[model samples]
Target: MRHNRTQHRSRRGTRSITAASATVLAVVAATAAVQSNAFGTEEEPTAVSQSPTEAQAQDCGAGTFQAQVAKAGDTWKARHGDTVLYTGDDMFAAMNAGLDSLTPNRTTKERMVVLGSGTISASERLKLPSYTVLDVCGTINATGAVATDTGPIFSRDTTDVEVQHAKITGAPMYGMFFRSVSNLTLGQIDMRLSGGLGIRIDNGSKATPATNTRIDDVYVSGASSHAVETAGLDGVTIGTVTARDVGEAGLLLNTTTHAEVGTVDAQNVGTGTGYAAFRMANRNGRIGDGYENNIHVNQVIARGGGRGIFCVSESGGAVIDRVDIADTGNNAILVENCYNVTIAAEGGTVSGAGGIRIAARDEFANTSDVTLENLTVTDSFIKESPCAENTVIKNVELVNTTKDVC
Candidate 1:
């Protein structure tokens, strides 16, 4: 169900952060750092010096690349083997020309590398074909308005595509958008945008739901919408979604199933609204007619935003292992009209937030098989209102707070 953004309630007054809250904050920061560094833990030996383009080419696996784009003076050049496909001022055009020059209907993957940093005044998106890898080793400054359905980079009806090391700055409709794609990988993307969404991956219809998608280490700031959003996706793995001052959820899963998420670290996201740091809606985690624990999250951290974790509109079957939430404007954790949900399976802490809530709307079935355990709540409360069935609340420590359960 779509939320009414116009009807926002007043936020609770800010509370002083205690020593306990500070400790939780530190833990959250450490968790984010650990996740960000997990893939780069191996030390690299010192090697011979190389030019920036040469080093970037090696990083992009350019030995297997069939096309290349490089900036020279005021112009960008696209080349394949000995053929110069394009030489122009538009970086986007040069990159696209490099892709278009590749041999079509190839059985194996074709790689392309953008060797250096440049700015593109693009009103259109750079599209990716199937069985392709586009490694952009340098920053891309995308400037100009785009159509509502397009973004800076997009792919549709594609299979086995990867984009690596993309650092973008713009207010496009989306930083990256992919639809009806299978076996897609987005690695180490950083977006600093002023408006629109950060990343969106979905199937245009349920008949062709995207499958086997992996997103590793994305950082988005100043976005007008969710940092990462997925709809109609199956078998997806998300490493981390880090958000700062985003207008909506840090990571939102809608009608998606078979998901594994590492961490969602958000700060000042969706203030004064019902959007959350992590949200599941539109029957997420559903398998067949029953709900399964298909959506698994390792950790979630939120500070000074709206909700911390939200499961609404018959979405559930998730196990959120840990959380560190503080000073949220709306409910710290809310499970509404959901099923088979468990929060803080390991342990967690919440402070100075609206606390945890379990509610149900009359239109849907009551939330069932829900558990909230192993949590320490400080300066907040936990309540199960109009209590549902088989709801479990155990091993909870309340400091300056109370629990009203039925």
Candidate 2:
């Protein structure tokens, strides 16, 4: 699948902030600015609440055109203008009630601001509809056993949906999940939990892939699966993916094309597995009927991970411009059964790692058009085994390193 399509911008507009909401808006704007800087993008960042104090102080319930769910002692209240939609202790119910009060079948976007932190059962999720924006200023702590393929936040087959300033904790099947969604934006999300995947987006069929997705400044810690994973996505833009002590890859892209990744910073991720800080599998970067350098990464910093970078399973057409990796358990960088792959195009360093390797499996075509240039390798090696074709290694500086090429 060639996903070399132009990214479409979201049609959401900014709302006027009152003096009372200035503090909350400032915090949200600051977080988005930091993410934009990290991604090296000039696009305006999405606004989100950063802390509990800010969430409480920002009484979004007072807005003329927005709905809100606020905690009042032991009970929660959902209101829109003069209408009181629901009042209960169940946060999930309160949120749904608030959402139900919005303009039905809205051609334009409507806002739902959830205030206060509370526990939502793992089996319960806040479902977002089209032309909807949900901003949770407080944390959502998930409890109980999750049903099959469930999460704290979910959206399916929706268009123009955005979630901001969401802080999710506790163990759920998935922190946040979206299926076949288009024009989606996730900004300033923080997931600190044990087990489950951090964020997952995918399409149900290969014919209809999710289009124009943007993820800005997501922090995932202690996830058993990938921090951010996308499948069958076209035109995806990621600002930064930060992972710490994660069980799998920091960012894993499968059957995705036309991806622009800003930075991946990972530490102690996928310590003993074949997963890498950044990995691409199952025709990740293929463009059109052939392959080109459609997948571009600005930088990657991996320390004490299972692997630094991996491109396998007939996936190729990627250029990782820079990398800084150290002491990885598996190959620091591995390109197997791929094509048109380039590593360290702008120069980088690999020290005390398992070294770089280029190989091919019998099940697929040999790895070809692979280039490794402008790199400094220390206490490592560079090997090209059972070799490929049109492989180039240039301007490489080695210290106590060996090369085995065939």
Candidate 3:
């Protein structure tokens, strides 16, 4: 199957503005100029109330068009290939009603442009071929954004779209969901104050998943669970995706996926009783080959989360052979129920989140084949457990440094 690619553009044309009188016309014309800066919309920004003074629709370039707004309850829909650009502050005034009135039909090629502060309803399902882009010039404030039901930017099957610099917040469910969508690219995505998992790359099943995309400069916060999850996303390139103030692991990835995580900082991620910072499960086939699938490199900084970095059970073939963890709230690197996981230290303190009660230790996954190469110790762990069997402490160094574990 191929995606029907369509584009929307704006053109120049002149139309007469309705006038109450020449005097009233002058006033509205002035108002329209100010509105062009406010919401008259040279290009849609946010929604503005209907004006009795001016009764002329602004020109929406060629393929480009402005959504017709009703008093407050009225809705206008878009046909296939029609692109709606917004420039309003209220979500209700932005895209929902305009999108809801659209006649549902087969996937043809339509795109919804998110301008400023807008809200998308849970019941407002944007169907296929109808790609949505979160395009905001300055800041897309979703601080009060809300989705009542299973609110998501995507559902069912979505293919081909680009979302940039839009803050997605206040959803009863996942912020942006990729169900069975294939071949989509999400860049500069921000998930703030969401009730569900921030962003889900869930294929909904183990059989089929989302593939081919670059997720970069994405930040997620205030999720009940994992901030960024890739349950079934395959062949995807991820960069600078960080989750703060989360309830679970910052990033969760599983299956035959390839990813490069740069600087993962999860503060208050776990809810005092949860999983690892970076947890990759599902024993990828070809243990050794799949082991290659294990998170290759990462700079995980976790403080106040249940477990720092965890790999378990069937998530074999992948190895935590070498990771640099620092200032952890609990166990730095906890490996359990899996194989080929190793711990190599770097930096001043490793998963050593300056906490008094913190175990201040790195745990080796038990009941599985795992090893640590060139593990180091500082004056902090002098009073802790000793190294033996699968563990080795080499060239331990800790002096002028303040590692409380000792």
TM-scores of the candidates are 0.85, 0.85, 0.62
> lDDT per residue, candidate 1, 310-372, as tens digits?
999888768898999999999999999988888999999998848899999999888888888
Query: What's model 3's lDDT at 22?
Result: 28
Clashes of each: 0, 1, 32
Model 3: per-residue Cα lDDT over 165-239, one tens digit each? 346666436666666666555545667865677777767765765665446556888888778777666555555
Instruction: Give the whole-model CA lDDT for all candidates, comma-separated.
Output: 0.78, 0.79, 0.47
Clashes of 2: 1
Deviation from truth (RMSD, Å), model 1? 9.8
Ranking by TM-score: 2, 1, 3
Flag regions of model 2 displaced more than 4 Å: 1-65
State how far residue 287 of model 3 sits from its true place (Å): 6.0
Model 2 whole-model lDDT (C-alpha atoms)? 0.79
List candidate 3 segments past 4 Å from native: 1-111, 122-149, 284-290, 319-327, 345-348, 351-406
